[model samples]
Target: MASGASTKEPAAAPAATAVPDPKMPPPEKPADVRRRSYVILSFWLIVLLLGLPIWWMTTTIYRANLPLDGMIDWADGKACRPVFPLQISIQADALQPQEAQHLVRLIQHAIDDLNDFSGHHLRLQLAPKDDRRIVQKDNPELALTVRLKAGEATTASLDPHSAALDITYPSNAIPSPTSTSSPLATYIANELRSTFSEEQSIISYLLSTSSMSSDVRPQSLTPTDLAELDKRMTRSLRYAATYHLTFSLFADGSTPNTWDIEEAVEKYMRPLLDVLSPIHNFTVDTQLQLYATPGVQSQVLHKEDLASFINAAEWPLSPSIGGAPTVNFVIFAGNQTIALGDSESSAETSQSWLIPQWGTVYLLSLPDATSHVSSNILRQPMLTFGGHLLTLLGTPQAGSLPLRLSALTRIRSADLLLRSSSTLGSLARLSRSLPSISIPRTVADGVATSMYHLERACSNLGGLEGLMHARIAEEEAERAFFEKSMVGQLYFPDEHKVAVYLPLLGPVGVPLVLGLIKELKQWSKKRKEKAKEAREKKQQ
Candidate 1:
């Protein structure tokens, strides 16, 4: 080789194979082999018996036991049947006790013959002979008082100021105790029926819409009647303990931004609210938005165009954050009038339109220079709004204020009972359908409370006491159904579990499996050796 010649280093020698030593260390002692086996077995035992169980216990979700069957019963209408017993009083101081009793019995029979619905029944009781009271305005227990007076002819008229029906009959029209039927009895029955026809129809409609399919339906009600009632029912707002009345004035220009809203509300609206206080609590708020525009920009808004009349995007009519539902009353200061495709005079006369389940929109034409709206100018608007408020509350159009409010209690209670039951049914279905979801103890407690209150409400359905229970039940049922924890669990999918465990399992699993396999092979080899030695010893 030349002195300065560069040469490549020899390729790395292949690694030498390790040879078994002929003089191996004495075979591993039995104690050591057993110790080795025990070590692997203890690791596996720790993983299988201790670690896995602890992990499972820690990861498992707690689900409280719910009264699924009872909830379902309420939902299906098997738990409670609603019945409203209306009390009617007969006022007849002019007649003898026997004649009054006979007339009362005959009138009840007439009413019974004309009525097929059993859920709503009118029980008539004779007023005290000395009781000269004509109107029972505060007594919700007495639905109506029929004042009978001897007159030239049988004529009936409802007292506009109170819950009294004045009926006059000829002296010969009085029925004797032995009389089976009389024209006078029939006339009073027809008149009473006509007076209460709207209420009965409303109550019957409520019962029919309930989940409990009752045998006592309004067989006498025609489809048109049902359709009209349905419309009213849909237009009404859902009952709440309180209602937020948001009065907003959307002014196209800065003019009319300031109004005598406080004065107008206190004077015109406060009295009506006081009347409604027993059933619903009211909270009032007034706001003025200047340079606001309506969604419809036209001189005459068609009926179809009225739907989008509220400028939701620009209008600050967001509902109150309080739990009570909000009712929006917006007055737009514009010359735009609603077009109902009616006569010009009728169209011009119309000042407002009601938005179903919402509130009302009143159009007021004002000059741009007018800086303020007086309480006098607000009188008609306030009155109109008050009337619309009652309609939105589902008040019957046929009865006096007291009787209508009384009926409202019954209607609201029934409505709450059904709503709570439906919510419970939904929750029960959710629990059954979603096994992985967790139900906290609060949910269980709420469900139990709701069912208990539901029972109480069902027992006292026709009274105001039932309304209290129904409200509580509705609140509890809604709270339980909307439990936040149950909703949170839906996001933890199965894929997340694999991603969490795979890193720890992959590295640790391989060593454990290999050690187990090697131990098994050694055991098999030793067994073979012992068997061969046994055969050799026997042959020798």
Candidate 2:
């Protein structure tokens, strides 16, 4: 017992000696431990409630609510089906009401047989036989009226001023009440079909080439027709309400620097421009380029030489300031004559040709010594250019100037509608595919404007109102799709995120987590001891 007590005493003495010295205040409180705990908690809270939310709020994309399903449906041809209902009037001046009715029925049957495309329907109506002549003079919208007269077998001819089909046919040919068809009806139907054949083919081609389904299209088009349509499409600019026409006169030497283009444009082009005002708005600026050189230096240009005639790099035919597309018509006055290829039989006249999607170039060959190109000298070239301008704008070849321009408006409206819809589709796809891109409020506003205009344009197609709405829709869609800030921010990548996190988070997180764990362990041990003491006291 004494040995055991002595050993125990030594142990107790060492333990007592091991007790903390009161002189050394409780080992300076672990400031780092407390600091680390606060740091960890603050960091976690910030990351959870503040940091993450700030990041999300700052970086998240602001995508405008788009009718994506509806847009897709439109693109897929499930939204609206296109139809053209043509109204043709018949005026039988030589016949009674019964005969006129019979003639109209016969003509309708004949037209039905002639027309293979179901989308375009021609309905015949009887025009009033009035001598007042006001209706005949005013109404051009009435596609055509058959003016039948009793005479020898007559031919079909369209009146120059009116949409009147003059047919002086034998009275015997008029269909009886019992008859369903007649020779005159067949002749009229054939003439009408021939007259509208080009338009029908063009519409059919447009429908087929567009995003619409193939089922809506008619039979396969001939290779020649397809080529023509492709040519037309290539030449035509994308639709816009306004067009900026830049008329430039480029000369190799510095003599003909000044042209009376302002006067010439006002005199010749202005009239045409005025006529086309309903369809397109025009702004013209004339410039004279001195010391300009052609891309090809050959004195006699071959067919290949034409491709390199305009030095695009040197030519200052930059697009205009406004959003409207710029079309350049250059009158290059030089002494050089262009030669057709090696073939001597080929005769390419006017020394002028059109550049697809760009403009027309006319080479005027004058005396080598002559300097100035006066307005009189420009008259012929300007006229040529004006004609080419119409072609370049995809105006139909048929019909009078006024009629062609009216058709142009309709075609352009359709073009703008399709383009805007396509742009909307692209924007939707881009937003869905690129999750990181930040969309701005401006984009939302533009999208809303675009959708509204698109709806309006779709509802009011085939008229001036449709053109206006389509133009607005196209502009808005382009703005939304090409929002500058959205594209600008893509440069800041995830690599940048990792780069920022490594330095601060790495060093700071370690100490904070370790302190938190230590505090938890210490608290747990103290709680266990207190519980044990309470149990011992109870037992006692």
Q: Rate the local accuracy (lDDT) of all candidates.
A: 0.86, 0.75
TM-score of each: 0.84, 0.80
lDDT of 2 at 126: 77
Q: Best candidate, TM-score-wise?
A: 1
Q: Which portions of model 2 miss their true places by more than 4 Å?
A: 1-52, 85-98, 109-114, 118-124, 131-151, 158-168, 212-215, 251-260, 289-293, 297-300, 313-319, 339-348, 367-377, 489-495, 526-540
Tell me the tens digit of each residue's lDDT in model 2 across 273-334. 99778778888887889899999886677778888888989988867657788888998888
What lDDT does candidate 2 reach at residue 417?
70
- As a TM-score, model 2 comes out at 0.80
Per-prediction tally of clashes: 0, 0
